[model samples]
Target chain A: MSETRMPALSRRRVIVTAAQLGAASVASAFLARHAAATPESAKEWLGKLAKGEAKAGKVSIKAPEIAENGNNVPVTVAVESPMTAADYVKAVHVVADGNPNPGVASFFLTPACGKAEVQTRIRMATTQNIVAVAEMGDGSLWTATRQVKVTIGGCGG
Target chain B: MAADVKPRIKAPATAKKGETFEIKTLVTHEMESGQRKDADGKTIPRKIINAFHCKLNGREVFSAKIEPAVAANPYLSFFVRAEESGTYEFTWVDDDGSLYKAEHKIAVS
Candidate 1:
């Protein structure tokens, strides 16, 4: 499976590169148009907030490994920051990949927060990955992901 | 509008100067996600508190953009540094244009 997939992936990459070289502006515009679509997936949410990629560090999520009740799972997200006017966390976006809607919540913070941390209860449709992305005042994005097994799905499932 | 919605806040009344403290808040609301169906098989319209804001002495402290995935009776916990003596104002904006407000005073020694 790996051998067959490698060539196919490389071929697609070559095609993409060719297209980019042929019409770099058009390709970028097309990509931007698609990126503007209503984001419903966890990766899309990260892309939207992080502006493309996010590093997996300086942020952490605390939650149970297994949630007996999917209706209300307590989660906390914290980012390492001094909370000073010069350096602080701007916002943190929580996204549950397996939920009906990927976005759980977005917390906006300021230096007065003193700590770049937030706790909230979120609903998950099923067992899935909960991703927390933190946007720093310096425009850097950090992320953390945790998987939770839900015995029963939320949304009355 | 959400029925009997009330905002509850937990914050210290006093703190050492420049000390960090925790603040927990909960507002009662159904947070109907519009994905549920009633007994008659009709969709229950979505009604939720979409936004929450916290301010200290007329300056923004923290805020959140809530979504349907947030459970009913949304609860939030965060931290604030005691810079000075002031009132902390909390506000929740419901989908039906209802504003739920609460306040707590903190003294920085």
Candidate 2:
């Protein structure tokens, strides 16, 4: 039985790769068209935001490099701030590059929070980069990101 | 009540006045991606929790708008400073307009 399963598993892998390649090709074409209209590509939205157009520095995001479950992956963002009326963090946005929809969560924070920190779990259709963007009271933006690898066969996919 | 929805809160039930504390929360939800089909080959209507808000002493401290792409059983954690002892209220609103709420109190020593 083990010998018989080995060949089947290899065949399944080949099929999966072919399917993924096909999907990637389709996605590339779609992105090309979409990018023409939007200033930022879906996958590079964070990078665009980080190129001095938005304030940079003092934000950190923690996420797993590999997620065993794609349906629910944990994410956390923390910012260094006094959380005072004058210097508090304003908002934190979570974006998932390569998902059907990249924008995942946007958190609005007030000085009453006393600290700028948020943790949440988000879904990923496939392996992708998750970016966290934080807006500060001084009209500045900071960001951090990590890549998450998701297993493909689970969740009835 | 939806069989799939589950809610939990993690926070210290007691804290000293003027102390800062962290709060963690999670809810079990489908958070349908709106891009998939059900078993009947029909598009499953998107039902996701779009907003979460926490209020202490009738004052807002934290709020968030979640998108459909958020993972199932969403977990959110944040920090708050306890200036005075009062009830901390947490509410989660779904895209379908369903609301889930939880409350925690802090006793200042």
User: Which candidate comes out best when scored by DockQ?
Assistant: 1
Give the Å shift of residue A130 in candidate 2.
Answer: 1.3
Q: Write the per-residue lDDT of candidate 1 for residues B1-109, one digit (tens) a residue.
A: 5458988999889999889999999998888987677988788999988999999988889999998999999999999999999999999999989899999998899
Identify the runs in model 1 with alpha carbons over 4 angstroms from their true place: A1-40, B1-3
Candidate 2: pairs in clash: A122-B71, A123-B71
Fraction of the true interface contacts (Cα pairs closer than 8 Å across chains) found in each model: 0.88, 0.87
Candidate 1 CAPRI level: medium
**Residue by residue across A1-157, what tens digits does model 2's lDDT show?**
5555444458789999899999999999666422222214553655543334454468887888888887778788899999999899988877877676667788999998888988887777677777777888887887776788887511222
- Candidate 1 residue lDDT tens string, A65-153: 99999889999999999999999999999998877677789999999889988999988777788889999898988989999998976
Give Cα distance to truth, residue B54, candidate 1, Å: 0.2
Model 1 root-mean-square deviation: 11.9
Question: What is the alpha-carbon RMSD of candidate 2 to the true structure?
Answer: 9.5
DockQ of each: 0.64, 0.59
DockQ of 2: 0.59
